[model samples]
Every structure is written in C-alpha cells, then in structure tokens.
Target: MLAIRKATVADCELIHTLAWQTFPETYKDILSPEQSEYMMEWMYSLENLRKQMEEEGHIYFIAYHNDEACGYVSIQQQGENLFHLQKIYVLPSFRGVHCGSFLFHEAVRYIKEIHPTPCVMELNVNRNNKALKFYEHMGMRIVREGDFPIGNGYYMNDYIMELEID
Candidate 1:
C-alpha cells in the first residue's frame, strides 16, 4: 500500500537526502554533471529547503510504500486561486507503483481544501523530461513554454503545464 504524510520542517534532512539520490537519476540523461551539481546545490540545499518551508509557505509531503519513504511532493500558493506544484519525484525503484500519482493527487486534495473554487494547479516540467506524458495523463496540459534562468548560466527549459481543479 502507498501512503503519504505531510512533512514538517524537521524532515528537511530526509527530503534533502532523497533529493540528492533521486535527482541525478531523474536528470542524468538530460543534464550534464556540472549542471546537475549546480542545480542540486541551488535548489536542494538545506538552507534553501528551509527557506521554502519556513518563509515561502511551501507545503511538502512524503510518500511511503510499506513504511519506507519512496517519494515526495511540494506545493506553494501562487495567488488567490493558483497553486504551484513545485516538486514531485519518486525514487526509481518506486516509479511503476503509482507513487507519483499518489503524491500528485495528494497535492490536489490539499489544494482543494485550502484554496477556493475555480482554482488551478501548475507545474514546470523539463521539455526533455520523460514525465511529460505522465503529467498529461494526470490531466495537465502545457499552457506555455519558458526558459527560466537559475543562475550560473543554467536555464530550466520547461513546459509550464496546468490542470484545472474541478
């Protein structure tokens, strides 16, 4: 069985460890080693994670399979009715077991409870990511494309996808 629980600031280390392990696996094919290393420090550093959870109001959830942590997801409110799905990842070994879907639905459920009606959830996925079809399968459509610079000359070439919450 798959279960997901809200993550607290205390779980930062665990999340960081998972990010370090799974990120490379996910981006190894699309990103060079230097780029991946830079991104890991830029996004998953303990200080940044703390800032995201503490100051930015980003909510995170960890997914577990049979009591073992396997994935995580995070979301942050972007506006009155807009929530950004900032992150969603499942360990490679857990990929086929619907862990990502579980985390995605959890984020949606949380958004519905916190946000008002007529809300929408958005996320940016790399243009070359294999998860593009998976996001589509989950009812998201690419609304636009962007090349966001994240320092050190690195840019996130992504498709900005959104799903309306009914």
Candidate 2:
C-alpha cells in the first residue's frame, strides 16, 4: 500500500529527481526542451523546495510505498478560498497505482480541514495531456485556458482547471 505524508527537507533531492523524470512526459510536447529544463531547475531546485516546504502558501508531500518515496505533490494557497496545485508526480513504475491520487487526497483533505466553507482548487495542465480528462473526471471544470509564463522564452498552452467544493 502507498502512504501519503508531509515531505521533509531531507527528501528534496529525491523529489527533484522524480519531478524531472516525470515532467518531460507532461510538458515536452507542449513546451520546448529548453523551457522545460529551465523550469525544472528553477522550480524544483533543492533551495527552492526547501523554502517552499518551509513556507505556508506552499504545501509539499511525499507518497511512500513500503517506506520508499515514489511521488510528491505541491499545493500553493492563494487566498482564503483558493489553492493551486503546483505540481504532482509519480515515478514511471508507480504511475498506474494511486500514488498521485494519494497525494492529491492529502491536498483535498487539508483544504477541507483548513477552510470552513468549501474552497477552490486549481491547476494547469498542458493542452496535449490526456490527464486533463482525468482532472475533469475528478470534477475539475475548465475555468480558463491561457499561456503560462515560465521564466525564459518557454510558454505553456494550458487549461486552467478549477474545482469548487460546496
């Protein structure tokens, strides 16, 4: 069984590796390799993860199967009623399993506990990713679609999906 829990600074390197490994599949077609590489190092660097984990707006978590880390998800709170799912990933071998769902459930559960009324959960997925259908199946609506500016010359054509809890 896979377990989900808060991630610690000690897990940074593994998380970075996992993010890079999973990211290309998620963005390579939607974004240039240069942009993906830039975004990966800029967004998943050890120092960046360290600060994000230490802060409140960002929530980091790890999925463990028999005590070995296999995946992670990061949620960024925007306001009293808005939370953005910054990233979610699982190692290739663990993809068919519920590792991603386990981490996602943690984010949902946390939002439920932290907010009195149902809040909004948002995320962006590349236009070509079939996972957008999965998000829609999870009840996330297509709120908007736009170009996502990741530093450097890379941009992503993504759908801004939102789920409103009621």
lDDT string for model 1 (1-166, tens) is: 9998999989999999999889999999999999999999987999989999999999999999999999999999989888999999999888899999999999999998887587989999999999999999999999999999999999999999999997
- Error at 75, model 2, angstroms: 0.8
Worst 10 residues of 1 by lDDT: 111-120
**Alpha-carbon error at 74 in model 2, in Å?**
0.7
Candidate 2 lDDT (Cα, whole model)?
Answer: 0.82
What would you estimate as the lDDT of candidate 1? 0.94
Candidate 2's residue-wise lDDT over 48-130, tens digit each?
88888786557778888888778888888898889999888887778877787777778888778778697899998887887
Task: Go through the candidates in order and give each one's C-alpha lDDT.
Answer: 0.94, 0.82
Candidate 1 lDDT score at position 116: 53
Instruction: Look at candidate 1 and give me any clashing residue pairs.
Output: none
Q: List the residue pairs that clash in candidate 2.
A: none
Cα RMSD of predicted structure 1: 0.7
| TM-score of candidate 1 on Cα atoms, chains taken together | 0.98
